[model samples]
Target: MQALIDQIEASLASRLYFLSIFTSLSLPDIAGALSSDNGEASSKKFIAWYEDWVRPRFRENVVSQSPPHIGQYIKELANPFDGESCYRFRCSLLHQGSTQHPKSKFDRIIFIEPGATTNVIHYGQINGALCIDLPGFCSEVLQGARAWLAAHEVHENVQRNLSRFAQRHSGGLAPYIVGVPVIG
Candidate 1:
């Protein structure tokens, strides 16, 4: 029993370590795009920002909403689709039913980065498609993303170290692919 407990602890530690590293690397990439001059003026920039920021948030949500070991279980059960990265893990959770969204037409639009412009992703029931609109609540989401980015900027060096580590262990890292799911 003791050995089993130890093994569980070790495994949890390992997963958390990987998650931390992954989330750390993601923050900068998202932040960079949000802070970039061109990003400031474009709605597409918000998508790039959330591509990284949403994963850990979703993981935490899963852990909180589900059982104690649910996160680990989901991580183990996750099927790595070709070209999908850790960043897309959160989005996958939604699509895979591991994470549930509200039944409303637009579930929740989270602006992971605060103080940035809001860019909304609209989900229409007619086509069951996600339509990203720049004029609505999306503006709030962008603003929130910017705020989150500003709060975490002090960890820039941590991001650099994580990047170096990523380069060294690139094989184990997931690839980030951007694509909308086709709702048929």
Candidate 2:
């Protein structure tokens, strides 16, 4: 898990935000499965893990006011990325190669590229779509996952599942491949 986090962080450091974001979104799936008694991966596990860890790190909502069609102004909080929406986003992005989701609250999700200046735009709504800071979003997920891993390091389920978790072998895995760096 730490190795996975390190790769994501390295991508972010190299300004490879898309790569970082893509992999970061998959962390909940991996960690959630590890935390489960059965050690099985599923959407339910992913959403629950994300809700408990990553969701709290995000802003409550992108827009705090009612839409124009309501005919009257009312305070409303529509969270840009709830567990379901984020899960849908992950599916759409990882499977379809796009951010558009048929069942998403927003038609699309946009990630703002990091700029050289200190001032940054981290999260907001734009044209009914969620705009997130690329680096900030990636970092939040990674940080949350790291904390979760630390807290659950000693759990029996986690320990059991970790044996199957994909990781880099410094000198390759034994009895199959050896003498070079490889991921297994």
Candidate 3:
């Protein structure tokens, strides 16, 4: 559970980092791309910016790879795929450049939306493509992990177990993971 907690914390930081990459705008870095007078930004340069904008589209990838121990501890996400399992989606995306599975239940996984909220993955037909909201999917994982941690926390026996586990992993005198002050 401690290790799982560590993984969740790491994932939170990682997703935030991924979020930064997702929202990054390369045009702002160039001298005159966003200038008031320069309306003729190179189309190729804009394409390059588009290339840089796509971040790691693996929030579902993480959910698919959830370990059994972690699985029991965390929230159970409603399976979203009709034609594909979570594992297959992860494999296809990781091995291939995009979600190019011909028989994929989802036509495309939505990585970036201008305004998306509510931590829920909604399936719908967009231009004949099955769309999955990336942030919403990741938000489900984050919420689940936090719920599990909170469930076992602020209790004497559980805290003791966590402390002992942390100590065992650290080999004594030091803490297991750096951020866990309760066990540190």
Q: Pick the candidate with the highest TM-score.
A: 2
Ten contiguous residues with the weakest lDDT in model 1: 77-86
- Per-prediction backbone clash count: 23, 0, 1
Q: Show model 3 residue runs off by greater than 4 Å.
A: 1-83, 114-121, 145-184
**Residue 163 accuracy (lDDT) in model 3:** 46
Worst 10 residues of 2 by lDDT: 59-68
Which lDDT tens digits does candidate 1 get at residues 1-184?
Answer: 1222233335434544333322332343445443554332232443455544432343444455687765557663211111123234334333452222343233332222222446433222224333322222222233334556456545654344324332222233334422433211
Model 1 lDDT, residue 57, Cα: 42
- What overall lDDT goes with each candidate model? 0.36, 0.82, 0.41
* Tens-digit lDDT track of model 3 for 26-49: 221221133213333443434342
Cα deviation of 94, candidate 3, in Å: 1.6
Residue 178 local lDDT, model 1: 26
Model 1 alpha-carbon drift over 4 Å, by segment: 1-34, 37-39, 76-147, 150-184
Better model by lDDT: candidate 1 vs candidate 3:
3
Model 3, total clashes: 1
TM-score of candidate 1 on Cα atoms, chains taken together: 0.28
Cα error, residue 133 of model 3, in Å, equals: 2.4
